[model samples]
Target: YYAEMTLVPVLNYLDIVGTVKRHLLGPRARNQVDMDFYFKGSAFYLADLYTGMSKVVFLCFWYASIIPAVYFLTAATLMVHYISYKFAILRSYRAGPKLGAELAIFGRVYIFPLAVFFLFMQADYNWSSFPFDNVCETNSTKVTDSYIGSHNLQYEYRDKDGGETNFLDNIKYPVEISEGDSYFKFCNQDMYNHSPKVFPAFPFFQDDESKWMSDDQAVFSWVFSILVIVVLTLVVNSILVRRLGASILSYFKASYKPQAITINQRFSEQSEISAYVPMKCDPSFLFPLLLCDISDIDTELIGWEDARNKYDSHNLSTDVIDEMKEDNEDAKCYCILKHFPPKKND
Candidate 1:
């Protein structure tokens, strides 16, 4: 889904009927100044793109260990993202809205690490539940306990060995006291609950039915150890991935680099700067003029020096140009914006 959302926009360079876009909303395409007024592409949403990719990242990390084939699917999805976004962001989209570094940085720093921890927990559980020649469904009460999470509501003194159980009518749910020690604990539950199955998962070294992990053991300490191990793994993996991923991207996406400011031709102040440009040499400014009924405009006053209509539009452009600049100092530097009238029809 993430890959699909990403690729669709990049590929949708042409609105064939040319009606989806409006003039004032979203980022403008590079050549939109020449395209039909309603045909320009929409702005790429970096935040939404990040959210979608993060969903894939989190899901991949959580389930990859349980089903090893998920590794390939995740790889394929991300690979699609890599190739599509690489081309689209450069060639298809505009320079785009400026975003903070933390927009991308937070997922790697916090989200990925937590995802890795979840991955470890899943991996540990799956590794232990192996050699599964014998498989059977758990009890219907537990299976049907979807919307009403049963295990969370139950209170008991025994180790969490309660397996899937039938919902006997008004029967007090049996709670395990010890290893398979099944008996009803008179707790004020709704007589329906999810009894946890005794799977030989983490924090318990299974010897026999003689012992189990209950509230008496140092469970927090063991959990702390697991967290430490997960952090260490993330640190090591991050170091390795940084070097390897850089080489990988460099190979596949040769143009992927720090978006450096590279100006091939610098602006010339004395010769090139101008408040107005004629349509004979440059026709780009004429695009805006075409949107209005220009037949009534005084054609003679367009380039005349007496054209006190110094600017147009929502009264902003002419004000700045006509303002008293900085207490009458020699105005050596100013933003030499292209002199174009704002859309009067908007």
Candidate 2:
């Protein structure tokens, strides 16, 4: 009910969006950035962080195959994060929503490791009747006396003679069978009457029936060892993948390096800087205008008094002139260009 009512609608919506996208851009083209549109302009930092942390917790718990506490916590955290993200998406960005094909690919990739973890859990069950201290479905119920010749009923047989006999080697019954000493010497009719004609095969060594390891023996120790190894493998693989991906991206000029900086001093000075620029000239060339020192002389503001014999004069046709410096202190250094049209040639 949960999947049909909730997930079906979501999948339908995605399908509809995908159909629309295919109509716009040909089906051959993949829309990788479509899903990003929802979070593009939103304040999704907290939601995104929590969502990723929830997945990490889930993966840890799944790989460990330990207690259920972490799984429950991760589930609750994921639910809260999903709700938080949905709220933010509804109220945040104004961009048109897009559904991306990468969503399905990412979902499958994330689930692949979990599937392996589950398969290992299944294998653990088949390994032994008592794989751990806690009893599982395989070992929940012990064999009853009603079923004779079963391995679980081994204690019922008495070992009479110290001699060993191979029953499968001969058609005649061994003499130890009537003596009631040989546990393996079961009556043909009784053996056929056992609930399961064939028993599950053991994967490990099958030296003697008494030599097998019970599920209760060192179960937690083995589980912990497996968990540690799996987690270590995952961490190492993640680090290698990150480094490899960065190296690959470097070829496309997409890789970045992080740098740290310290602010040694902080000061603020209010100032105004403005300039008249021709539209044809690029703005990049005008960057020096903002860096001009405030102490530089402005040729346009110089009057006759400021220019009076304090500066050497030079006649120039252009209204713009280069700044000049004076060696003497208290002597103003400035530039004055001859006005345009030379005062109408009067």
Candidate 3:
């Protein structure tokens, strides 16, 4: 009963302390200049809007007191912290651009804290219930002692008759196990108990004591670290190269020479030949006279095939060409009649 009472106030105090620490020492906590700058920013604007709404509610008798101020301050602090954390994470990505480094930074900031919190919770639960054995046993020890020398140990096997038998005696390891007894015999029936053959209390977690990970795990870790470093170095170098390229291009553009323009006489000659010709009469008034030329040409005289081929080659309809031909004939006839009047034979 006393423990529960004590724990409640302690927990409440810890919660308050944590909140204070987050506000005062978090990434958002900065100098006066920075604080003023942030206050003028969007974050401050939102906080003010919320605070104003709260004041309006209090005036209307919906809210009690200055609790709104406290809430607004807390919300503003959390918002600033969130923004700063996001900027810091993005900055880390820009620094290296390596997947591993990005993951590591993300883990450090977000995942690691959560993991620590979970571990602390588990430890707290464990501490509340003392003298309990979990998954790992405290007394178990693996014995590797053999009667034969370490090199010759491979030849020895267990026998069915509870005697030692050797592989070189024309017997398989399994057959020897059935024929002999060479496997280690435990002194205690409890599997958790260590054999009398091995030294007690040897630290298996240490590098010096661990037989499996001392060499292989170290090599793997070293290789992984070197690879991550190389990748990060390459990413930084690539960015630098791109920036240098852009600078060089800008320099070239600034100092570039302009090419002189030269005119060609051939184009000028073609333009002169294509000059426009003026019409003799207004097109609207001479419509009927234009029709008089085609009045002499028979439309049925031209076959479809001939007309199509002729039109395709000349880029004109045969009927139009026949009309022009008739016009020329009529003009010749008129000239003959004007020059030589018809002799009257009355």
What is every candidate's alpha-carbon RMSD to the true fold?
A: 15.3, 23.4, 36.5
Supply candidate 2's per-residue lDDT for 194.
27
Q: On residues 64-125, what C-alpha lDDT tens digit does candidate 2 reach at each position?
A: 44444545654655565456446544544233323455544544445545545443443343
TM-score for all models, in order of appearance: 0.40, 0.24, 0.15
State model 2's lDDT: 0.38
lDDT of 3 by residue, 157-250 (tens): 6778988765656533332222233333222211123233221112232223212223543454344334434544554454445546666888
Q: Candidate 1, overall lDDT?
A: 0.47
Whichever of 1 and 2 has more TM-score, that candidate is 1
RMSD of 2: 23.4
Name the lDDT value of residue 99 in candidate 1.
76
Give the clash total for candidate 2. 3
Alpha-carbon lDDT of model 3: 0.34
lDDT of 1 by residue, 145-199 (tens): 2343323233334335866554435435542223332222222111011134332
- Model 3: which residue pairs collide? 158-177, 158-180, 158-182, 159-179, 159-180, 159-181, 160-178, 163-181
Which candidate order results from sorting by lDDT in descending order? 1, 2, 3
**Of 1 and 2, which scores higher on lDDT?**
1
Question: Given candidate 1, what's the lDDT at residue 54?
Answer: 76
Task: Name model 1 segments beyond 4 Å from true.
Answer: 1-36, 90-92, 100-102, 128-346
